[model samples]
Target chain A: MKAVTYQGKKKVEVKEVGDAKLIKRDDMLVRVTSTAICGSDLHIYHGLIPGMYDDYVIGHEPMGIVEETGPDVTRVKKGDRVIIPFNVACGECFFCTNQMESQCDNANDAKDTGGYFGYSETYGGYMGGQAELLRVPFGNFVPFKVPEDAEVEDEKILFLSDILPTAYWGVDNAGVKPGDTVIILGCGPVGLLTQ
Target chain B: MDYRLEHAKRTNHVETYNFEKTHDIDQTLLEATKGGADVVIDCVGLDAKRTAMEKVETALMLQGGSLGAFNTAANVVRKFGTIQVIGVYGLKYNMFPFGHLFERNVQVKMGQAPVIHYMPELFRQIQTGKIDPTDIITHRLHISDAPRAYEIFDNKDESCIKVVLKP
Candidate 1:
């Protein structure tokens, strides 16, 4: 499958890599139809993020058609359209049940932080989505089905995988009250998207 | 106004300021809200405007990133207010004002947004014209142009606010 791989510091190349397939009982294979370059991707591109292995497929925000699903993948089936959120989480974890999927206990490589696609080893080293296909582990928890008949462009909803949601998370976690004069500092994607 | 300030005005009642125009940004913010902004959110994080000393050090490759926005956030948020950070920070921060926050009783909230949790609601808003994310996008290119896209956006050239790669 074709993917974007890290060549070296501040270098990347889109080339052929190994095809992604279902690896676990809850895994699912997604044929990526649309993917976006996120601000965090710049962290990897600029060498700010450490411990990134070369040739790791490097994109976290994407949505696509399900090519195959393992026996345990019940939330979505083959042929369903889905958005693969950046955080790879096990739905049953304490953090997941509390809607803090980013801190899900099961997906971390180290002690506390949860798994993230194409991020460094600090977050679990899940392969990214900037490829022809992706292996979505804990697939049932992170893949949200999108309607086939929806009359919206993929660009409109692609950010849901990261920026847009992160924006909302900022507002929600801040406990922003009605009529509160909030000062959102940055004018970047996440900053701009935050409600 | 940049994309965010403009988009925000249409959806909510808000005022924006360009710190570049003012000598003291924290002071400007303090005076604008009649004391201080009730909630000062740090969206720039590490990319906050750096001072001459910090700029030279960063240019010399002595720093990973700066927490200038965090400092300003702590300064400008009203006493007993909330500070929300949506900006991405690479790692640990130095010279951060921990003492001032304690004295002012300001609460800080920062983290990754639960993307999946908010998707359905934001999707509906986008579909219904309550929010328009596309207003912020300035360029759309093919996936093959990822390198060029990164270069342009990173350099902040051509009025590039955001670039979308079709893959």
Candidate 2:
């Protein structure tokens, strides 16, 4: 299978990589139909974010058809179209139950942060979604089922993997109220989305 | 340039600023908002305001870049106003405006945005016409052009606000 891999700082290339398959009982294999380059990925690209290893596949946003699912994965089936969240969260964890999947204790035990695919060793080193296929851990908890009848474009919904929700989280975190003036400094995707 | 400053003006009624043009952002915003802005959010982080040499030093890992935007926020936030820092900052800073922020009784909230937590509501909003996240995508390239795409976005080239790579 073909996937994008990190060559070095300021370098990324399309390369042949092994195919993805179900690794854990809660895992699901996704045939990626759509993916986006996230701002967080750029951080990894620049080598600014630590713990990144060479040849690590890099991406976070992905939505596609579920090719296979582990027996423990109850929320999504093999043929279902789903959007995979960047964080690989076990629904049973303390943080996951508390609506904090990004900080789920079960995914990345080395740090307080949860498992984010393709970030590096610090982020649990899961292979990313910018590939022919992806291995999604704890699939039942993270894969959001897209409606069969809905007709939204992949470009429109691909952001659900990270940025859109992140922007919404920013506004929500700031406790933005009606008639309140909120100032955003950076005009990057996340900042623009927040605006 | 797929700029959306007009949207801010129309919906949020926000006024834009070019910090380079205005020598004193705090003074300008202070006067414009009548004393100060009620809420000041710092999305610009470590590299917010740095001299050319200062940037070089930070790049060489000499001095830590921190609180450039926070200082501006501390100055422009009204008495008892709130300042939300969305920008990532350093663990240590040579100088911090603790006195000003403390005296103003300003409320501050800062942290990583819990992306998954907000996904459901935002997804619903996008399903409706309430929000459009795709509008920010200024460039789209093939997966083979991923390297160039990363360069353009990192450099902010050609007014590139965002890039969505088609893989």
Question: A11-74 in candidate 2: lDDT tens per residue?
Answer: 9988888898888898999988888887667667767666787778888888889999999888
lDDT of 1 by residue, A1-195 (tens): 888887777788888788998889999999988887787788788777777888877889888889999998888888988888998889888889988888888998664887888786778878888888999998778898887788777777777888877877788888888988878787667766764
List model 1 lDDT by residue over B13-65, tens digit each: 55667777679988888888788878877878667767887777665666647
List model 2 lDDT by residue over B1-167, tens digit each: 12545544554455777666678877987888888777777776664667676577667766456456788888888888888876666445655677778888998887655566666676788899788777667787776787888888877786776676665
The number of the candidate with the highest DockQ is 1
Candidate that would win on TM-score: 1
**Model 1 chain A worst lDDT window (10 residues):** A186-195
Question: Residue B158 of model 2: what lDDT?
Answer: 68
lDDT for each candidate structure: 0.80, 0.76
* Model 1 misplacement above 4 A: B1-14, B52-64
